[model samples]
Target chain A: MSDLVNVSYLAVGPEILLTLGAVLVLMIDVFRQPSARVHAWIVAATILAATVVTWFQWDRVTGEGPFLAFSDMVVIDEYGVIASFILLLVGALGLAVAWGMVERLGRRGAEGIVLVFMAIAGFQFMAVSANLVMMFMGLEIASISLYVLAGITRERPEADEAALKYFLLGSFASAVFIYGVALAFAGTGGVSVYDIGAFLRGSVLLKPGVLLIGMALLITGLAFKLSAAPFHVWAPDTYQGSPAGIVGFMAAGAKVGAFAGLGRIVITAFPLYEAEWAVGLAILATISIATGTLLAIAQSDIRRLLAYSGVAHAGFILTGLTAGEAGMPAVWFYLAVYTVQLIGAFAVVAAVAGPTAAGSPMSDYEGLSRRSPFLAAVLALFMLAMSGVPLTAGFVGKFGAFAVAWRADFEWLVIVALVASVAGFFFYLRVIVLMYMREPAVAEAPGTMRARLEPVGALRWVLIISTAITLAFGIYPTPLLDLLSTALPF
Target chain B: MTELVLFFIFGALALVGGLTVVAARNPVHSAMGLMLTLFSLAVFYVVQAAHFVAAVQVIVYAGAVMTLFLFVIMLIGVDKAENLSETIRLQRPLVVLVGLTVVVVGVFVAVGGRFAWITGVVGAGPEVNGTAEAIGDDLFTTWLLPFEATSLLLIIASAGALALAFFRPRRREGKEEGAP
Candidate 1:
């Protein structure tokens, strides 16, 4: 009873580093109001340091079983480490993509940077935590930050409404989730994933009603975060209402964390009940893909369109999950590529629409090719990638996910997904055609030009890196696949 | 026997309080009913010998959270009774069906022996289970990560609240004009 547990802070190195950076930014904002550029540098340095730390952990940390630390609340594993590295990249690119907005907001923008750091830290925790309560806390930390980020621009009534709706719905989801956690704890007599898994493995209950209900509730809550159907009502509104500069970050970061957490729970803790969960997940995937793609066609707002598309993408990721533990690498690869493309697409949005404004009509993008050829071309590339065009990362990702689902005997779901993807091509290509082929529709105003494009600085770097990666991975996916094959979250 | 009687009384009060919360016309009345439910729940904890939980429940839920709710209700000026209109089509009937299903399921679970596994494993433990020291030990050991993570969550909440609600950025101040 008196035995001391060996605690290692190194297990949470990335999280600790990012937290310190968040604190430092907040303090700097208070004491000596730094410019957004200075804060960007700080954020960049912190992300680089965190990445280095993750790389070090990748090499240093190895064992037959997961090296659990902090009284067995967290594990230092390659799966989490690789995910952390990808999350850091997402954070870095997200910062670059939103730099214009930061500069626009000037002194107040430091909080956005801090919030981003906090969100990344929370997401890192979500990936690494082994305890249910700890995961919930991480979810809350990330979510609260997102709710505020959604309403960062209070001047816009839409932003206010988006924030309020998100808060209300998100809090409801959290309540449902915590209730499920309590049930799981009561049923299994444990809150840690390891303990719960051991308990379930040790016995066979004829009527495991509580655990089943817990799993269902848990899936519902995470589905809401992932923006799956029936639980995705708030997504389009929130995405359209939030500042254009950071919506991609918010969406991508949340998805990464949710997928990691979901993979952890489904693969590691609840494998015994695969038959039960896979059916539910398949249903969710079908509805999400069908509803998301069908509704995306009717949307004129680019942000809302992207929101629906994100829902469809969520369905594709869930297809990967249907393969159980065997599907984790595919999910990881898909998330890594998709999130980069998501941020890049939104960077273009931020450039076209002012960083903080809402109400960007699709018509605004007409003749985007002539006005700013670089932005138009890159945006088209991202759109093509998202549509799963050949020789793009999205194609490989969708193929991997669909193949895994097929191998898992979700043949009907694969057929549905294929049809949805083909239907998805129309809207994605519409953006491309509108940008290149159509002439810029002249505005009614006398002196005003039809469109105004901002001078993109750091965003260009984000676009270049994302586009390069998307094309590189599409043409030769073996390297990334090889790397991801080893990073399985066993 | 006295403890059992006290338990029944508090449990009855809690159920009635919950019904009042749903049935009350005025929002303020509903809030009052919520306080009653919370207070009764604290009493239930007390009966279970979870003195710390009982105290915290009273302090946090009945005292602070209830006060905050009342203040928000007063501020929003929604304390007046609503018309109880059915806005969405089929919403009332759907809610009724769902509510009935939930009630039926709850009754079945409570009466069924599905939860026997819990009691069989835990046994009828002694009063030491709910003591402050026992909770403290667990919090410092097994639950330490969640406890500390809570601070980070609070920080995010505060920072987000401030950033969203208060921080006002001057628009295009001290910048060159007509650049783009």
Candidate 2:
């Protein structure tokens, strides 16, 4: 028993380190009165340390094959390790991209950094949690931090609106999720994911009405977090109004964590009901792809356009999920490559619009190529990658997802996804066209001409790294695909 | 016989309290209605032999939470009555339609096939008692991780409240001149 307890502590070492780092940063800010640069360094170092710990955990788990700790409340497996790595990567790059905003916020920067740490830790917990209630707790931790992060610039009315809307809708979804947990517990007499699966496999339930309803509600709650269509009303407003610098992290992190949780629940706990949930996911995918593509074309703001595009991406990822356990590798691959592109694109937005600014009007991108060729070139690459043009990471991701979904007898979903992918190029290419072909809208007033948008400091590094990864993986995706093939939930 | 009588009385009280919460115009009155409902829920927990849970429901909900709610109401001033007027067009009709749909669904779920709401095997898992000892043992042992993780939630809540409510940025000259 003592050995087990000790092992449990070791298993959760990364999470503990993150939590400690958050508190430590807060304490240092209070006592030392350090600059925002110091806080950023602390956060970066903490993320680096956590990644190292996760790497060690991956080594152990791969050797032993998915170790459960804390009385099976958490499963330390390749799936969780990979998810944690993605989240940590997002956190590091996100902090770098948002560094200017943090410095501008002055004393409030420490709180923002702390919230990021806590949010990342929370999402990591969500990825690893084995109990339904534990997952709920993780979701709340990440969500509350994000809600505050969205409104960190409280003086901006748009920020306030975004925060309030996100809070209200997010709380409603949390309530629905917990209610589903209760109903599932009542229906299965179990709260542990593995135990629920065991119960379903052992006993034939004649009246699965309550359980089915619970499952639907759970899916709905997660879908809202993933920003799938129909539940994606909050995405456009939140993304458009949030400070530009960190929006990438917020969007990418939530998808990674939510998909991890959703994949685990559907594939591990409720695989017996695949036919039922697969159809539900298929419907959500169809709606998301259609709505995201159509609405994205209509958006005048760059941020809102990205939000709608994220919805479409969620549908594409869900297409992979419809293939059940067989498609998890495709889903992970898509998530990794796509998130890098997302962060990279938003980094350009941060440079164009000040990091603390609320909106990124599409007009700002006109004549970007003439101003700063570097920013325009990278942004174009990201846009092309998002559109799934040939020889891009996005193409590989979409292709992988489509192939698996087709084999799973979801050929129709694949067909719809293919159509949506083609339609998606319209909006994505529009940004590139506006950047390169069109002249600056304010060229009439030489005095009002905006300064050259240069990627400097940490933002430059973020762009370079993301661009390298995007292209590298686009050319040769075997290494990542091979790694993800081992990242299966036990 | 006494248990049945107690159940019926509290059940009715809970129903009435829930209705009054929605119906009452005064915010204070609605709070009182919510308290009554909470108290009735505590009674239900006790009736199920979940003594610890009942005690917590009373102390946490009926006692502490009610006091906080009343304090907030007092701070906001009770003279302001809640506006019951509908602002959006067709709002009332849409609400009624949704309410009717929910009622129909509830009825169908209750009366469809099996009358028993809980269809799981009753004694498949460990026998649970309502004692603090049993709950504490499980909480400290099997549920220790989640229990510890709850501290993170509390920290986030408090920190988030602080960051949102306080933490104003100092205005720099020429930068924030045009805003607000």
Candidate 3:
């Protein structure tokens, strides 16, 4: 059947590459002595190669899969292409960090790479999912990997606790999401966002309970992914427990892909039901800003603080989500900016946080400028960007988010954002003050961390590029704005 | 209709399964209850005509995942788990309260939709095929950028996780091994 061939050709390009890479890494891990492993790097390189190949094949109509397989559940598209590339790239970075980290933990093995590829593959499926069935499957694949990943360092009890909590809460959220999908399917005879959008375009509401309940449940599930208020309870614990590198990976890579999906669902498919969902979203946004910022201020632990800070930023992104047509491009640009800034900040933290179990607390940053002014300055720039100060990438992201919102007649949302920005400044500034302005506490632990503070590695260089772009965009944002102009969910 | 009857059966199973997952004293019992819950979920997926998804739900989630949970319980040695938390904590009350609140909120939100702002204005009902062709047409034409960007994002993640998880421990601290 042509169907079989088409499906193979269409889905096989990226899917086969990822699946084979994952399987290959596993097989090789079995034979290679743990002490003499080279397969991890090979796996990383192969993934990049596969992604490049997939990118080149983007000349065709992007969503056109080879055949209608999986019961028409998945489709390849520009969306899928972008998602796949990002997933693979971020996965490689995770591999590199793990390469350094595994030696630190004294656990050299193949399971980590296998799970990473598996998760990347899962995220790829999610990007291409066309129906509720595929979407749920994709989500499960990604989530299962992450659950195991949280506890990969099986030696750490906190890792186990974090994974357990993440697993349970994630499961509950998945159930709610699927239940909502079922109801939505029942109500509209449709499961995909586009299909739902078509059905809702010119109709008056019926069985409103089904739609409203579905939206609420779906939002609850997505809120957990976004790590927004109320549903964000698991983030800090999980982030703290997981390896610092994994924290960076999830915060940047996962957030971008997840938010794209969320934006599509809300702005495109469910816009017709704005009457039911809009107010709730606004309330959530407000709460996220308040709770996340306030909670972050109380955290002495760097990872926990970043986790809460991540929550507040998600609220900022939610504002764009609420802005409808005007919000899409803004949200996209913000996500890209957010991803880079976060990666840079986490890299610095991971590199410089001094010799404590969870690395140095916020207090350890004391006189970081004196120790490594170069590192402190780099981090300070990122923190300031996070604060949305002028001449930085964060400002452009925040400005775009607000501009679109005001254009969409949500001026009050804009005001709240302004206030939150000011409130957020206090915490970021405290980090800076401790680094440059204040003396470290007297009762400090021994073994001062003396790793070279220069941004020497490829990863560090990558962070520098992101920081430079942030500054460049802040000064002349027109190029990015133009690119954003075409990214639409309006 | 068979559809109506099937709904009630699976719904009942799901409800009971949920209750047992929460109330079971043993960790293994809870895991089994969760498995039942997941199975009921697959049944619902099957009822809804998602064959592949149903199979995945049963095999991947219920079988593979539940096995892991049970394994962990065994590894930790179920005896190590307390039948009940002795310390009076806020966890129990909070759990019960949140559980009841979901139900209450569900009921209210469901009923309240009748009074929805666009109740009289929006009127289309579910009848579209939602097949691969339909979704493909829309996605290829409209959702293209997000599609590609998301894949790119995931690829990056894959490399990073692999690098960390499979990373040879000898790169950075070749000297750490020499420590006496």
Best-performing candidate as measured by DockQ: 2
Off by over 4 Å in 2: A1-7, A444-449, B1-16, B81-88, B109-116, B123-127, B169-180
lDDT of 1 by residue, B1-180 (tens): 978898899889888889899898878889998998999999888887788899899999999999999999899897455678877899989999999998888668657755433511456545456777888988887777778778777768767766776754334432445343
lDDT of 2 by residue, A1-490 (tens): 5444434666787889889888988899889999776787788788888988998998888887888888888999999999999999988898899888888877777777888888898889999988899999889889989999999888788988998988899888889888889878888888889999999998878778788888888999989899998999999999988888879889998999899999999888898999999999999999999999999999999999999999999999999999899999999999999999999999999999988899999999999998889999999999999999877888899999999999999988999999989999999999999999999877644445466668889999999999998898889888988999988888
TM-score ranking, high to low: 2, 1, 3
Task: Please compute DockQ, using alpha carbons, for every candidate against the native two-chain complex.
Answer: 0.38, 0.50, 0.13
What candidate 3 gets wrong by more than 4 Å, as runs, is A4-12, A34-44, A61-72, A75-89, A92-98, A102-109, A354-359, A440-456, B1-18, B26-83, B86-88, B109-180
TM-score of candidate 2 against the unseen true structure: 0.94
Top candidate (TM-score): 2
Q: Which lDDT tens digits does candidate 3 get at residues A1-490?
A: 3333234345536656766776676566567545524665667567877777777645553334332343345555554555566566566655554454444543334556666666776666666666655566666667767776676665456766777888898888789778878777755667877677778885656556767677777777768877889889988998888766566666765576567666656765788877556667777888898889999999988788888999999989888878775677788778777777777777677666421134347766787776667778888998999999988889999998888777777789889988989999999998988889985545334454543355445446656666787788888888877856655532
Instruction: Please identify which of the two predictions, 2 or 3, would achieve the higher TM-score against the true structure.
Output: 2
Winner by lDDT between candidate 3 and candidate 1:
1
User: What's model 1's lDDT at B26?
Assistant: 79
Residue runs of model 1 more than 4 Å from their true location after superposition: A1-5, A62-65, A443-455, B1-12, B76-87, B101-122, B125-128, B167-180
By DockQ thresholds, what CAPRI class is model 3?
A: incorrect
Between candidates 2 and 3, which one is better according to lDDT?
A: 2
Q: What C-alpha lDDT, on a 0 to 100 scale, does residue A437 get in candidate 2? A: 100
lDDT per model, in order?
Answer: 0.85, 0.88, 0.69
Native contact recovery (fnat) for each candidate is: 0.42, 0.53, 0.10
